[model samples]
Every structure is written in C-alpha cells, then in structure tokens.
Target: MASAVRDRTAGTTILDALETYLAAPKPRDPGDPSREEFLDLVHATPALRDHFMRMQRNWETTLAHAIAEESGLPDDDLQARALARFALDIGALAQESPDPAHALRTLFARLRNGWTDFPHPGP
Candidate 1:
C-alpha cells in the first residue's frame, strides 16, 4: 500500500527527470551533479534500482515499438535496432557531442541504408 505508492512516486520523479533531459534542445553536461547524485542514490538502493530497471525496459520497449512501426522491420530485429539507437543517443548525449544533431542525422541515414560497416578499398 504505502510502499507501493512511494515506489510509484519515485519512478514518476525519475521518469520526469529523464524525459526533461531527453527533450532538452541542449542538455546539461553528462557529469552534472544531479545526474551523478541520482545515479548514486540508485546504486545505494537495490529496490530503487529495480524500479529504475523496470522503467528503463519500458522506455526501451516503447522505442522498439516505434521503430518497428516506422520501419516495418521484422520482430526479430526490433530489439537489436532499439539497442543500437539507444547506444547512439546515450553516447552522443554523454559525450557532449559537437553538433550532436547533425551527427545523429548522418548516422540515422546510414542506419536506414544498412551501412553496417565502413566502406574501404582492399589493400
């Protein structure tokens, strides 16, 4: 009862923070204290970590659905594509990518075109 409410509230708070970060035109640095503090708090509490993991999976699943619907990709490929997209976004954000928007656009184009390996001439 009370515990469930508390956990729900915590999940909501974290979700809101994450959404704000993702929606921002320009997010704060990856090393920001708030990000570190929240990560530390989660690390210090196993129950909280469980909630966070659930939220993360939910978020990823949502992304996967969108990708599948938009690309008409096979069900077997949805998870891999979702993970690749997730890694690209997180790496770009955490590294404070110079021209992140442009980089993302370029990479997305390659993804759509199946550029899985860099092209080069044989020796």
Candidate 2:
C-alpha cells in the first residue's frame, strides 16, 4: 500500500484512490468490479490496510472523547462503555439502512440527539 501511495507512475496516493472509489456509484450486484477491485487493492497494500486500521482506532477514540465531553463523564470506563454502545448502534443502523450514506447521516443525527438529551454529570 505504501508503494501504491508513493507510485509516481499512477500519480495518485492511496487516499486519492479511496476517495475516487467511494465517490463512484456503488455496485448493485455480485458481478460489480468496484467492490472486488477495492478489496483487492486493500489486500495487496499492507500500508493501506494499516492506515485503515489506524483510522478506525482514531475514529473510536475521537467518538469516545466527544461523547465523554458532551455528557460530562469524567471516568474513562464510562467513556469506553459509551463508545462501545455507540459503535453497536452504528453497526445496527448500517445493517438496517439500504443506503450507506443515509445510515451514516442517521447515525450522526442519533448520536447528537442522544447526547443532547443526556443529563450532564455534575462537576
């Protein structure tokens, strides 16, 4: 993946490729090359896989921090639990929604509303 990112011949980074892939219309059937091609790219590139894993970790941490701050929860354990619950809800939403984009938007809206409704912990 590092080489793919640095490939001067391609004139594009792995991030650029990812953006292009995501921006394109999603495949409707099993024969679609987009999904397979993207997976192949990821599997072939170790750096891309590592980068994605790191991004996932960072995303979870960021979400946990945001939830903790908004809810005024000082305990690390509480933040971790909240993050786990949030992730589960997101997974469920993604599985239930036909459109991935809509699912993501709904997840954000749900999280924001939930946090807003939560009673902040006293200092």
Candidate 3:
C-alpha cells in the first residue's frame, strides 16, 4: 500500500501514487469476519492486540515520513497529519459506502488541488 509513496521513480507525487494505489481493485472474501468481529477477536487475544497496535504504529511512522517529504510540515504537525489521514482511511472503511475506494480517490483529488473549492481560514 505504501509502495507508491516509497517508489518515487514512478514520476508521481506521493498523493497521486497513493490515490492510484487506492483506486486499484482488491478481492475480498465474503466469508471473512467483519470489522467489528475482527476487533473483537483482537481484543480477545492479548498477543494479537499488542501486535496490531505495533503494526499500526509502524504504519503511522511510515506514513508520517512519506507525508513529510511533500508537506514540509514540522515533525509534530507531520505526525498529526499522518494520524489524521490514517483515521480518515479507517473511517472510510468503517462506513457503509457503495464506493469507499472512489471516496478515497476523491479525497486525494481535492487535496492535490489545494482544496481550492473549500475555503480555508488560516489558524
């Protein structure tokens, strides 16, 4: 998933590559457990829960570094951006959407355009 971000040789921005990657179709097993079920299982297993947390942290770190390369945000802000992005992705997955992957692409498109369609008041 982070391959797009790490491979800059593709001549695409991190966001662009990420969006493209997200747009790719993935096969899902209908028999697989739901998100809630998966969480329940994780909570029931101490080792799994710990491992899950560690993996999430490592992914966040990878994301932070990727985002920082383009945004030039300070470390704290970069970390926050990475966390927020990850949360948004999780939220998209959690929601009952007909096209979550498309939603993700739209989000990146808006971001790549500097979100010009929306007004932003500086803090």
Candidate 4:
C-alpha cells in the first residue's frame, strides 16, 4: 500500500493542483464537476488521504534533514522544528498570496539568510 502511494506521487500531485488553483487569477467554480469528482474520490478512498498524509510527513522530514545538512546544524529535534516552522509559515504565505512563486522565493531567501551564521560543510 505504501509502495503504491510512493509510486503514484499522489500527495505531490494534489499539492501541485492546489498551488495551481491558488495561483489562478480567476479560480475555478466551487461547484466544478472535476473538482467535485476529485473530492469525491478522495472522500470515498480513505487510504488516499492516509497516503497523502504519510507522504507529506515524509517529505517534510526529508526537507528538514536536507536543511540541517546544508546549515551545518546537528540533525536534532530543534533543527527539525525550525524547518517545520519555516514550512508552515511558507504554507500560510502560499495560501494568502496570489503569487505563490514569489512567496516561495522569499522563503528560500529567508532560509538562506538564516544559514549565514553557520559555517558551511566543506565539499
């Protein structure tokens, strides 16, 4: 089941769709049939939601680890918390702003600035 979810990249696809929707100048109608069908499919399949949640968690953790490594921080709970917090803030920005790409660029710049205090790991 987990393998199936991983293969499908369902969570990423859903997230991409949501971002596209959010970025649209004129959003789709609330009663859109395709949107309704997608929601219905997710509602009818419990495993899909579970898989998405799991994939999202895994993606966050992986990103946290990468951030820790890049920042030369110990791979500890504190670093994970920092990364998670940053992600949550970015998520909020994405939801609130029509230009999510710009929000993401700002996020990456902030993250890079945050890493300036730490010594980079030598290649």
Highest lDDT against the true fold, candidate: 3
In order of appearance, the predictions have TM-scores of 0.46, 0.39, 0.57, 0.41
Positional deviation of residue 99's Cα in model 3 after best superposition, in angstroms? 2.0
Score each candidate by Cα lDDT. 0.52, 0.53, 0.65, 0.55
Report the C-alpha lDDT of model 3 over 1-123, residue by residue, as the tens digit. Answer: 455566755567666666666666667799998867898899899999999888877766667666665557665575646644664464446344676766675566666565557877889
Worst 10 residues of 2 by lDDT: 1-10
- Candidate 4's C-alpha runs over 4 A off are 1-44, 88-97, 101-123
Of the pair 1 and 3, which is ahead by lDDT? 3
How does residue 116 of candidate 2 score in lDDT?
69
Q: State which candidate, 2 or 4, has the greater TM-score.
A: 4
Cα shift from native, residue 22, model 3 (Å): 1.7
Reference-based lDDT, residue 84, model 1: 35
Model 2 ranges off by over 4 Å: 1-40, 78-123
- How well is each residue in 26-106 modelled by candidate 1, as lDDT tens digits? 566767676557878997999999998887666555555444443466644756455535543563464355665555555
- Candidate 4 per-residue C-alpha lDDT over 11-57 given as tens digits, one digit per residue, 9 for 90 to 100: 55322333343344556686776644765786688998788667667
Higher-ranked by TM-score: 1 or 2: 1
Error of 1 at 19 (Å): 14
Could you tell me how far off, in angstroms, the CA of residue 85 lies in candidate 3 after the best superposition? 3.3
Residue 29's lDDT in candidate 3 = 92
Could you give candidate 2's per-residue lDDT for residues 71-110 as a string of tens digits?
4666365654565455645654564567866766556556
How accurate locally is residue 113 in candidate 4, as Cα lDDT from 0 to 100?
A: 64
What TM-score would candidate 3 get against the native?
A: 0.57
